[model samples]
Target: MANVNTAPSWHAPHAGFIRVLVGLFTVAALVVIAMTLAYPGPDPHTIVLVSAGISLVALNIVAFTLPWGRLPRRHTFWLALAQLVITILLAGTLYQTNNAIPLLALIPVLWIAFQLDWPHTIAIIVALGLGCIAFWLIVEPMPSRPRVIVAISVFYFVVASLAILTQANADALRRSRAIAEEAWRSQQDALASAESNAAVMRAIAHGVDAAVFFASQDRSSTFANQRAQELGRRMGVSAQDPTWAGHEVYGPDRVTPIPPEDQLLPRALQGEYATESLQWVGEPGAQHAVSVSSLPAVTEAGEQVGAVIVAHDITNLVEALHAAESFSATVAHELRTPLTSIVGYLDLLETDDLDETGREFLRRAQQGVTSLSAKLRELLEPFEVAGASPTFSFIDVVDLLRRRVNHWRESAGTRGIVIEGPDGSSRLQVPLDRELAERMVDAVLSNAVKFSASGGRIEVAVDTHENSARITVTDHGLGMTREETRHAFERFYRAPTAIRRALPGFGLGLATALSIAQAHGGTIRLESAAGAGTTAIVEISLTQVGVAARGSS
Candidate 1:
């Protein structure tokens, strides 16, 4: 911000006001000259002096109004001095007649003081004072009175003081006015910027579907968006009280009161960052599950100022989880009772009394029962998969995969789907949990058969790459879009295409397969496109904790 004011250099402090004052002085001088010219019996000397005074008045007008900046800097002092000389001579000539004519000297002295610096101003004042005194002694008869002498001295002193004081006050006032105007403009700019930022923040806080709020350290000031205000009222916070308190907050259990020290807002204000601290607010019958997260507001110097808190309504998610737990409990109790009775009966029917074919069928029935038990256990494992560790056994991966493919063939054939396999009889030994590996394979193979069109082909392969085993299962059938494929392995996330086609599935197949693969220190991924097909690859690491090295087959 440099001052870029383009006003001309000739522009004076209060230029218009100065012009008005000078104009008045010119008019007054003209009236005096006119009065002198109109005298019925004017002397020739007086007549000549009146004409000279008129000419000087006209010159004074031009000098005062001209743009002094058009001339050189030196010309200013000379021109100002010339104007003062004219004023002095004209006043001296007319003083004997008008007596009051000496007052006109004030015009030039004041102008010089206003337009020039102190040194030049002092010179002009001294010259005007000497000229007036000289005219008083030489131009007219002296009234030898002590009162007249004292009055002249006092008048000159007062005039000089008035000029100096007026100029100083004028300069100070101009400077103050300029500063005030600049400050006003700066305040306007700051106010507009602050308002614009507030508008953007309002949109962001309200645009999102979450409850957002802010508060000062002492809880004396606060801000909350529309949703937060609604949530606040619902949480039993009074409209008049501070948003920080006036409500009872409970933990996720919806029964235990959350102590003030453990609460999200209190902790954050105390300079802690707390995230996803679940709270149940409002009365028991009308409570809502809110996941509140908080961060301490701090200055650049790391001094804690206040707190910022965001809350999300997790009522649906919490309710869904509760329902799932209850449903699992009910299903487990009902199914296990009948399953136990069936196992007891099967054990009582001894295969020792049966023929070879009967014993073979009996053996198959027992295996099917064992598989059902394994399926139940797999279903429950997902609830605790993140912390579950696999118990590894040195097992042949190829054999296990081949057996799974063989077992799935009959079921796949009912839809005319044919299964392929890893080429040749090769043993690829890897450390793995045997039953979990079989379950992972079964999940992938089942999905391949279920989604494939009639007579569609499937390929299963297990290969040794470096020190790891890779299992790939590919099917030529309906596939999925990129968006759908991204989330297809999330539990219960059936693809839109699958759901539209009325496919029978819980969308749990790939999720289960993925969990088991990761448990074995492996990864499962799919490459898919709509109407093209899908290829699922499961890769397992050869190394495992506490397991000795096994050779590749």
Candidate 2:
């Protein structure tokens, strides 16, 4: 860096200031010459020369006062040349009177060289040389005048050349230094910006409701956010420690500690990315159920440099899942036991000594019992997510959608709502378990109607394909926020709006729909915003359904 204080008080003169000073010097010379001629009664040659000299000095002063701003910058070159001519004429006169050496002729040459470029400087130098030679030839001189003039000219030429060259290098150096300084300032700004961004990221991590920790590959350094540090303290160790203190990390059972070798940080540092490694942290009362995900920090060249772990407290989510499962198991168990007895009674009631109507009623009752039993077992099972996928069969999905839309019309009519869909004989055969597929379709439709405002409208479209199908259900409903949409398919995860409205639901509808779709190798997504409405997009694959159907069969 350059020090600003190095510049001296006596700075170099500006070109305009130098011109004014030159004018003033001429005025002083004219005053002294006029005073000296006052006593000599002034000879005619000398008198005419002094008069010409006075006019020249007056012209120079007039130039010094010229409104240079209105003039072209190039006019300065002409001005300096004009002064050079006047100086030479006056110098020749002054020489005649007192044999004075004319040093004033060098001023304009230095002025041009200092303020202008190489071309102007060269012109000034050449003009000065020609003027000096002409002056010598015009004046009466004795004894080897040519040799004397040549030696004096050579000396002035060397000094002027060196001075002009030095000025050019100084200008170039100043320009280069300015560019370097600008580049340095830009680099400094970029570095400061990077640090500011880094600080913001750290603050976000610290404020988040999760534990974030990182460890270097060499295990020489570690970074941890507030939550991570808090968790570490509860577990009797610092988060910076690569290894946990004792067996503080418990498995999903929450009773047994995980092995040291199976720990998250250790494995992650060794290039293992452990995703969704749910574990219990801290002791008993203070224990938190956390879903830990460890990612190996890798370079573009595929080398792992270190590892980072992010863990969120999912204690409430886990507890809710368990409670819902327990309730489902209890309901299924109670209903199944009573249904078995009802089936036995229906079988015993069947007899030949019955009227045709009575026998038909008995058969219908038995069929109802069988169907109800199967539905309870499949839908209410606590471990349904882990169970085998239902069997698939060829079904007209378009017809199914048309019928479903009609079925919901009655329920919608109760709230002055309208449900619309395909009406004509549109046939699309897709390999899907009819009951399971219907359940999934019903779940989305139910939510559409249940969450919709009174007098809302729903548009259902069934797009047909040879090997797939897409069902889009758009409803003008009390829509969900981004957070709600993200966790909409989480089992027993209800939106805050639904809870606030006291909506009657177990929050299992969309969750069940998601499971069924995924089991059939399909995709389901919801698009919604608060008070805007919801659009549920469901796409099912015929190929995946075909494979599942064949495998089950």
Candidate 3:
């Protein structure tokens, strides 16, 4: 059979004392009852004395029990002291009557040893010994029997002392273990809470639309989230493919690796910190903008463990910043025109007149004023569309182009630039904002006339394509370079060649034409080369004519 280990439940430090007291009293009571029944003494009331002594001992045990689960220091002290006093009294009384039991006298001493400290135990033992000596001297029937009583008392004290000391030591150990177990459980709970909070923080961080990376002590990427993977793709870095880990960034591909001394992971591992925003060019044709931040994960002792990197995409932010800068430049360019006109008019009016040179200067001043007025009108056109959405209406492309061409025909005639268009040919209906579409065609034709040399030929071609109508304005004049064609749609972007030869004209006509085409879900494209002719093509959809009205109802 396997051995089973068991222990007493709910044992106070003084429980052993209480049990011993109860047992001694019960023994005394049973002895008294037995004597009453079997011996039938002359004064059977003698058994009553024994019973009373037992009752007193029982009372002491009850007192000890009353204090349990209460304050330990006072309860233990009082319990041990009362038990000692009651045991000594009862045992001394019985001994004086020639019925002294050394075992009974030893009860309080053993209890004191178990419940209280060693000094109290020793005091209890001394008191019990003194009471035993007094019992022998005053109440023992035979003087010669004193030695035997004393010897028995000494033996009882020794046995009780050992038992109490052992019990006290065991209780102390149990208390210590209880404290340790409580501390350990508290630590475990703390660890679990910390881990839970960390998980929640990590989840929230990764859920954001920014790249997140965690690198190990060795600087290898341990965790790369979705955003991180996407950024890596743009930067020509891959989690699956081995490469220089520190090179993972948002911008263009780096032709050379970052210096080891300046690397984020290495510095983080070395207990240093670094983070900054950088612009880089990716492989061949990559242009990505990013802001990167890195920090070190440190231990409790402040030792660096790992590193975390967060990369945020700032491409849109970069573009918006650029747009604001461009707008500022355009505003300056627009203001220059009006300021130039005022300056020229002031100069011509102040100068002495009545000569050919002065007359020519006056003519130039008038032209400058006219150019400034036109520039202000173009600058205000975009804001007009801001409050009013485009209204698309069906109109014949040939008629529209011809009407706008004829409107500018007298101006073209004076400039010796022939504005021949539509050739009175086939009609093609196109979806467009009627006013905006005509203005777009007029702007292109006007530019063709303005830029063309005297006697230059300008052609307006209106035709139908796969799913849309196209308006083409071709001019045999000074052409634009490839770079100019690319930026032709930018407001205030005048071609270098055109700016060198033309009068004062803000480069907003083509940009406005392109914006109108886009508002109608259409497009405008330019084809031109230096020394070669230029063509401006505008295309609009048929559905754009009535889609807004259909959606409104």
Q: What are the clash counts of all predictions, listed in order?
A: 0, 0, 6
Provide the RMSD of all predictions against the true structure, rounded to 1 decimal: 12.4, 12.2, 22.7
lDDT of 2 by residue, 309-426 (tens): 8988898988887887887778878898899999998888888888999999998998899878866754473256447567888888888888888999998999999998875577
Best model per TM-score: 2
Query: lDDT at 40 for candidate 1?
Result: 30
Better of 1 and 2 by TM-score: 2
- How far is 207's C-alpha from truth in model 1 (Å)? 2.1
> Which 10-residue window in model 2 sums to the lowest lDDT?
2-11
Which regions of candidate 2 fall more than 4 Å away from where they truly are?
Answer: 1-145, 196-316, 331-388, 455-459, 465-467
> Per-residue alpha-carbon lDDT of model 3 for 1-553, expressed as tens digits?
1112222234464555555566666666557545445645465445655665566656655764664545564355555555555555444445544455545545555555555666666666666566656545544556457576766567656756675675578569768767766766666666677777878877987799888877778765377788877776766654454333434332333344455455454455565666764544245345566777789877899987788877777777767856864684578577866677786766668556558887787778778777765666666655444345776555677888788888888988887878887876677756566887776776687678877878889888877777666788899888888898898877767888776776556777887787777777779998887777799988776565457535543
**What's the lDDT for candidate 3?**
0.66
Give the clashing pairs for model 2: none
Model 1, 454-542: lDDT tens per residue?
99999999896665688999999997789988987877678877888897766778888899888777789899988998999998877
lDDT against the true structure, per candidate, is 0.74, 0.75, 0.66
Evaluate model 1: give its lDDT: 0.74
Alpha-carbon error at 88 in model 2, in Å?
A: 24
Which of the two candidates, 2 or 3, achieves a greater lDDT against the reference?
2
For model 3, the stretches where C-alpha displacement exceeds 4 angstroms are 1-45, 53-61, 64-67, 71-73, 76-82, 85-101, 104-107, 117-123, 138-142, 149-153, 156-274, 277-290, 300-302, 321-553
